[model samples]
Target: MPIQQSGKRLRVPWLRKLDENDLPVTLPVFMAYCMVAGSLRSWNRIGTKTIVTLVTGDDFYYPVFAEAARFFARQIWDGQSFHGNVLQWSDKNFRHEAEALRDERAILFAPLSYQIQDDDRLLSDAVVPLGPRTIRHAEAALRRARLPITGESVELLMTEPWSRLSRAFQDRRDPLQAIQRLRSLPKAIPPAEPEAASPPSTLGLTLSDTHGFGSGLIEWGHDLAKDIADYKAAIIPWRDVENGVLISGPPGVGKTMFASILANTCKIPIIYGSASRWQEAGALDEHLKAIRASFEEAIEKAPSILFIDEIDVFGSRGETDRNSAYMRAVITALLQLLDGFERREGVVVVGACNQPDLLDSAITRPGRLDRHIAVPLPDAEARRSILKHHSGVTLCSADYKVYEMATEGMTGADIERLVRDARRSARRQSERLNGDHIIRHLRPLIKLPKAYVHALAVHEAGHALVSHEVGYAHVADITISRWRVEGDYRALGCVEYDVAADRPRTRSFFENAIAVCVAGIAAEIEVFGSFSQGAAGDDAADLNRATELATAMERAFGMGHTLAVEKFSPDAFARMRASDPELRREIHNVLATELERARSIIRMQRDAHEALVTRLVDADQISGMEVDEIIRKHRRPTVSLAKPERRVAT
Candidate 1:
């Protein structure tokens, strides 16, 4: 059969081909092959011998495969007495059995220790294939069994097999009710004596397993681990150790992973729930109920870490309109749950959000989700560590550095995905992963058009040149290369300026800084005969900073035309243009004066500026020394006055 595609769904032909070939299969093809074999016993027997095989790296799924094999053997024999042997591939007994059965027509069941090849003749021609399915199938099954469950409830039950067993053994076939009962069970079940010091308990994890996180995070994890160990040893009060933590960062910065690792390292079970899970309950009451249930579950599983991801959904009351009473109620309920944390022992709530500013202050304030930690974008060394961790294949230092440079501003998740993509590319070409493969994957993502590159080069060159000329001797580096584009601000390039050790901090210093900021636009106007939208962001940011400084000098320092030193709120300053005309005029003048100064400076240093831009365009990035050399070689020559030329009158 041919594979057919309609819209997003593809009608796969491999399964149909397997059936046509009369292949022997196991239960939950991917998860529980034994269960599937129990259901398949009613099928008519086939005369032809069949061989069944299971391939998975996970040992957890082995029992399911074994049960399925036994059930399948009984069904094929139609209740006739037949024995089956289970043996490892390397066992001498298996080798003897293989030799004796070499010419006999019989069914063989073998479970391999590694992934099977897609084109393996035995698998393609004889063994049935199975793939993993998420909760959608389980949801359908529950619905067929006349059980009431929201998609969120199904997700909760699908966490592991114990939940599934609870659902199966429920007195009343209500999944939600069963889940409630399960939550009320004693969370801290003492382990069997010998099993207490086992590998599974530790999960083979430590704070060292975390990559690309800052020292602060490492210390935080260590502190949590110590607290957990102390609590276990009855050395510290439980309440002192179970504070709610709010982790804020950009998406893909591993905020969620950090929370999970903390729980794992401390050998505590973690109850994973998100705002979306509750919201998916459909109705407002249902949403609130789901939220309550999640909290109750967390409380029941005391000594566990409850991770509430996307916590920004319960934003500040001021952020919502009066009409959004439902949202307001949800926020109130969440606040109550957070407050109730005091009554519950051993449950540490960790809330993760991309927009921490939007969260309710009451929740984030002390005594609630008090400990606020910011997970920032990874630096060069962190990027290198992230790359090394994700790149299971060998990569040299040079290759790592190249990857690091190529992935500036990218999050840890982005780096991992990039490596995965590069590996895929290498596999497609049947070659080992290399720098070329990575570069090939990254170039299209990071590279800009030549025209844009030139504009960006000119922009950064202007900033570098103006800053160097304004007595700021510390010029770090300039570049027209970047991996990511921020919102509305498509950064073509950037210039890093290192401040001089003894730089003055005065009104004149701020004015010069404003000139440096505007110089990029001035360069564009001077070189291109007009400026592009590229400088809009720089213009706004610099102008805002400059205006703030000027406004402070006038309003707070008594340096305005009136010398009245009257302090005003930020709101008042915002309305100053309409209410206080003179102050607005003064700000406009300050901005215009700095703009003209910047333009004039660019005009004077045109030759040096052009040289820098040219170098930036060619090299994409240049060091501070290279920039200084360019400026020194092309700086406007200062001509000394002809000393007493009038003496030539003799």
Candidate 2:
């Protein structure tokens, strides 16, 4: 008999069939039997305390079958009584609980296993035996469930995708060949859409079209493509080819999109998969099988790109022991597959992850995921390119430029979302897409709350004013808006100053920069009567810079009162402060002196500061030229105060 029925002579057909000698049990038959038994027990007004135990060998089907039993129980009993437990025979603690469950007449659900023992021997009276599903039983279940199998007739059931089969069938060691015999029996109905249709390719996109990537990245891609072309044309040897590239960056920086585009540019098919997909199988062996299948498919489709998204999921060792052995085995299999790529030509493995730091060193070692590409946030120019790419033609060049400036520090994906939002706004208004519509939609996304706008304007205005006074000639821009809202929306504003990339560094330079950093806090104290936490970020950073400069002046440059150059450890510095009160006094004096200097600078240019703050509050952003115009209009050059002389080494 397919199902081993004991104890009761249930009237269910499948169970009755099990009483006969000729019946062959299968997964679907077992599932149907459980469903019918649960429903009959409820219909016949069987006591709610009755127990049912299901036994099977396939671990993957344990949960599914147990859930099926409970679902039918609830539907028929109206939720009065239905409890199910899906236990694996391999669970280490199963033996401890099995006897107690048997004593309490608890319904046990398990897959058939040769190693069944202990309390399993006690449930012999109520045991229900389930076996591999036959094609007929599998089809009946699908028909009852109203699910569509592929267009293939009954004869092709064995040749259909494994996804259509039960876990029992999928768990087979040789599933493909095992299903072949079922193909000779009959014809099947065609599906409306072919399941085998290829997904849309992204080959048309080029590196130039994908903004926010650096020039070096674009060049590398071009070189890789060239090498592939050269190899195809016999211009380069196979061994000279680049193997694989690992792309790492913050999320939404276009790593996956770049992979697709790269594959398209290289004129190769891309096979994409992720660890999460393999993890859905719910068993260690099944996950490994899926991983092997994906690699095998990639190898079979040579001249292809294998793009693994979120590769960090297979993190370094010691992450989890729940599946440590399985994870290590999976990683081992992956290592082997990656090594195999060297012997095979035309296949490139691209692994993209947000946390490359968490990945195992072995996975990213030489010759395996070798090339590392970082996709950084878009700079102003790249933002311009991305904005223009996503904006409608209705938006003029000037509009694109303005939006680009506003979108500073945004990623290509963020820009795309902004453009999409703008388009949606335009569509809702039933008006032509234009700059005004885009800005209207974009403002709320990038602007701060109304209460903080004035303070932010004051804060950034102070930095701009101080930077100009300290000889930072090129103040790029200042704004009370952000390109993106970070955690908790605490950031109020920013000041962008252009410093020469190769400028010389000196004590005076560091001092001026420190003053500029603290100017915001100084402005808040001077204007708002008391400072808020708004200045905490700037104050802490500026104070750290000032402290570092003071430490360097005393220890490294021999610029302190004592000429002896000596580096002090943190503990030594703390001791020096405690023992020599004057040393602590000197550091405090330097920072206080810088802060007072910034305050004086702001005080001297009070009119320009007010005008700039007003403009910033009203306009939300102002360019360097606008700032210069404001300061130039309100110029009142006062007699400069004599600076304090530095303490020279005795």
TM-score of each: 0.53, 0.50
Error of 2 at 322 (Å): 6.1
Give the best candidate by TM-score. 1
Task: Residues 1-650, candidate 1: write the lDDT tens digits.
Answer: 99874322112211221233323222122223333332332232443244433333322233334444554455454334344532222221444356425523233333343344453334222443333434644454344334664764566445444312322232222343344434432122222233221123224556787677688877887888889789879999987784688888776777777877788788887777778657655446767888888778888877788889889867677643432577788898888888854365777889998768768788977768888888888998887777767765545777665566567667877776778888988999999887677666663344456787788887888888888777544678897773333221345577888876565455566667667777787788788877776454332444555676677666766545667775554434555555788888897887788777767778888999999988888888899999899999999965321111112232
After superposing candidate 1, which stretches have Cα over 4 Å from the reference? 1-205, 320-323, 340-344, 396-402, 419-440, 443-457, 465-477, 482-490, 497-513, 526-528, 537-590, 603-650
Candidate 2 vs. truth: CA RMSD?
Answer: 18.2
lDDT (Cα, tens digit) per residue for candidate 2, span 147-223: 45444433343344332233223222123322332332111222334333233344489776676877767788888
Predicted model with the maximum lDDT:
2
The TM-score of predicted model 2 comes to 0.50
Model 2 has an lDDT value of 0.63
